[model samples]
Target chain A: ELKVEQNPLFLSMQEGKNYTIYCNYSTTSARLYWYRQDPGKSLESLFVLLSNGAVKQEGRLMASLDTKARLSTLHITAAVHDLSATYFCAVDQGRSGSRLTFGEGTQLTVNP
Target chain B: GAGVSQTPSNKVTEKGKYVELRCDPISGHTALYWYRQSLGQGPEFLIYFQGTGAADDSGLPNDRFFAVRPEGSVSTLKIQRTERGDSAVYLCASSLNAANTGELFFGEGSRLTVL
Candidate 1:
């Protein structure tokens, strides 16, 4: 069974500060994804890391994948109140159907 | 619909009652998936369908939970003898083609409350 774990389940950071959310998986899959969910809303895609050493950045959010270590990280640079939400990392099993195992998620709260 | 659509945005049922949730995939999507999200938890895969066939239903908790994608466009999830543990948000997702590794798009989800 593939397991995905994320650190700092609950995070409280002040605006303009920086933080990083870590995602570690138990399998050898190379495809990983990051999603963000607002309160009472569905998830939206953030980043798709397709291979080793792949990194993607949008705005203040950057995500990287290290397949060899079975890990991925979502780094927030200069966080803002709008960035506060629940973020999840999902690892694709890389099978025909691409079954995804997701981490528990990190709930971020940005305070001014 | 422009995105994946799930019916009965919220459903409240008594214990042991039957519940059914529906999902409508994108117009051209060939792959659909079902997932369950409990309070303060990530979505867990419940099943996957390729067209009209269920390619993988391994994540289903038990036999009491069943899903069918008749005609391949719309899918229905049936739960029998529901328990309090079944209370959670059921999410539906769809993709253009699983073989091509298309990005999965998720619905807003149907929140089920088994009281």
Candidate 2:
């Protein structure tokens, strides 16, 4: 079984501060995904990291993958209250159809 | 549909009852996935379908949980003899790539509560 662990499961940040959420997996995977979920809403894809050193950024959020280290990171820059949501990182099992194993999500609160 | 669609947005049923959840994936998406999310937890994989066949069902916790995508566009998840532990938001996602490399677009999810 593939295990995924995330640190700082609950995060609270003031406006203009920056923080990073880390995801560590137990096995090798070809794809890593970052997702954001608001309360009672669906998970929305934020970034898709396909390679060992792949990095993607959107607005104030950035994500990167390190396949060799079996780690992925989601960084928030100049955080704002609108950025508050539960974030998750999922790793695809080395198989078809993208069977994903997700880590316990990090709930972020950006306060003004 | 503009996005993955799921039916029965919220369901409340008695324990031991059977329930069915439906998912309508985006048009032209070849891959579909099902996941379960407990309160305050990330979604856990339940099954994945490539076209009309299920390519992977290893994430299913038991035999009572089953899913099928007969025509390759819409899928249904069936649960038999449901227990309280089965209560969760069942999420459906779709991807355009068969190799599982594409970004997954998720549905709003069907929230199931077993009383």
DockQ scores of all models, one per candidate = 0.76, 0.82
State model 1's lDDT. Answer: 0.94
TM-score of each: 0.98, 0.97
What are the per-residue Cα lDDT tens digits for candidate 2 across A3-106? Answer: 99998899999999999999999987668889999999999999989889999999999999999999999999999999999999988865656888899999
Candidate 2 residue B115 C-alpha distance from true site, Å:
0.3
Summarize candidate 2's per-residue lDDT along B8-37 as a digit string, tens digits: 999999999999999999999999999999
Q: Comparing to the true complex, what docking class would candidate 1 get? A: medium
Instruction: Summarize candidate 1's per-residue lDDT along B31-87 as a digit string, tens digits.
Output: 999999999999999999999999999999999999999999999999999999999
Worst 10 residues of 1 chain B by lDDT: B95-104
lDDT for B99 (candidate 2): 73
lDDT of 1 at B50: 96
Instruction: Going through the candidates in order, state the TM-score of chain A alone for each one.
Output: 0.98, 0.97
| Candidate 2 wrongly placed segments (more than 4 Å) | none
